[model samples]
Target: MPQPVIYTHQLTRKFGDFVAVDAITFEVQPGEIFGFLGANGAGKTTAMRILCGLLSPTSGQANVAGFDVYRQNEEIKKQIGYMSQKFSLYENLTVRENIQFFGGIYGLSRQELKDKTNVLIDRLGLHNEANKLVGALPLGWKQKISFSVAILHRPKIVFLDEPTGGVDPITRRQFWDMIYEAAHDGITVFVTTHYMDEAEYCDRVSIMVDGAIAALDTPAGLKKQFNATNMDEVFLQLARGAKRGD
Candidate 1:
């Protein structure tokens, strides 16, 4: 088995006596599609920001992509990609232009950028649309392109925060296919989502309630343990006990 690419021990983050993350512990193996699920106000986002080196934990230890989140944050930043639910892309830029722009921000050489852009455009079947403005594309296509740009630098791990938040079923299905392809190519995927059905697609899932992980197991395991019919029911059962948003 590959050593865990992401490891967190007693990871906690607090704000003025309010603990967003409370000593959560977990491991994500190389190439695994690990899901972090929770309701609104859950500490999942805090934990992810720490893992991505965008935020520091008040206390505890975390290593992302084999680099310490505190001391080696810059290194961690270079080795990981991030795609938010908003699908950040310049509306005025063409599909290929947005790809080129973000790739340059990651310091890809001109030649490297060109090579990767061509490969991504072909792989995503965006050949005809590559020159069109991104603002004109459908949400599904924009999402696909957003994901492509995020990984253009070939980061070892990609943090996806609600990547499929509002897409249609067919588009969501297509997005997961891209995720599966990324995992197959040995890129670890760390994702957070509210969609229980999407939880079923993960290799393993950790569901957060309040500020700590209340359940961590495979979809089948969680279902069996909770005697629930599906992830929606399992999540519903756990979420009922949450103490937040009161």
Candidate 2:
């Protein structure tokens, strides 16, 4: 069997007296779509930042793409792509130019950047809008383009932080299709979403409630364990009993 692509053991983080990530442990396999789910203030952000090497944990260990998050953050950064909720493209830059700038940041050569840009534009069916400013594009197109840019350098894992925050349901479904394609091609995706149905699409999901993972299992398993019919019920079963201020 292959080793896990991401490994975390008792990983923890604290802000003053508050425990933001409370000794959580989990593993992610290569080519897996791992869903990280939680509500506001659930500490999902803290855990993700720690894994992405953007924030240091107060205790425990994590290895992302075989590099230690604590001591080998720079190496980890090179092996991972990140997309946040907001559109990350430069508004003034054209669709093609946004790709060029991000690709260049990854240290791609001029030829490599040009090749990748063309491929991305073609793949996203943005040939007609390739020269248009990103600001002028609609939300769904920008979302697709940003996702394409995130994977341009072929990072082993992509971390998506609420990548479909404000989009309509149809757009979100289309976005998940893009995610499936990326995962099928061997890029492990670590995503967090409030959309329970989206969690259903994951190979496995972990529900975080107030800084701790309350449940970790496949969608069916979780629903079965909770005696629920859907992810929304499963999530609520675990998270609903929590005290508000904790």
* Residue 52 Cα positional deviation in candidate 1, in Å, after optimal superposition: 0.6
Query: After best superposition, candidate 1 residue 105: deviation in angstroms?
Result: 1.4
Clashes, model 1 = 0
Model 1 weakest lDDT span, ten residues long:
80-89
Global lDDT scores for all candidate models: 0.92, 0.90
True-vs-predicted CA distance for residue 55, candidate 1, Å: 0.6
Consecutive 10-residue window with the lowest summed lDDT within model 2: 237-246
* Each model's backbone clash number: 0, 0
For model 1, how does the per-residue alpha-carbon lDDT over 1-246 read when each residue is reduced to its tens digit?
Answer: 778999999999999899999999999999999999998988888888899998999999899989999899999999999998675789999999999999999999999999999999999999999999999999888988898888889899999999998899999999999999999998899999878899999999999999899999999999999999999999999989999972
Report the error of model 1 at residue 44, Å. 1.3
TM-score, one value per model: 0.97, 0.97
Q: Count residue pairs with overlapping backbones in model 2.
A: 0
- Model 1's TM-score against the true structure: 0.97
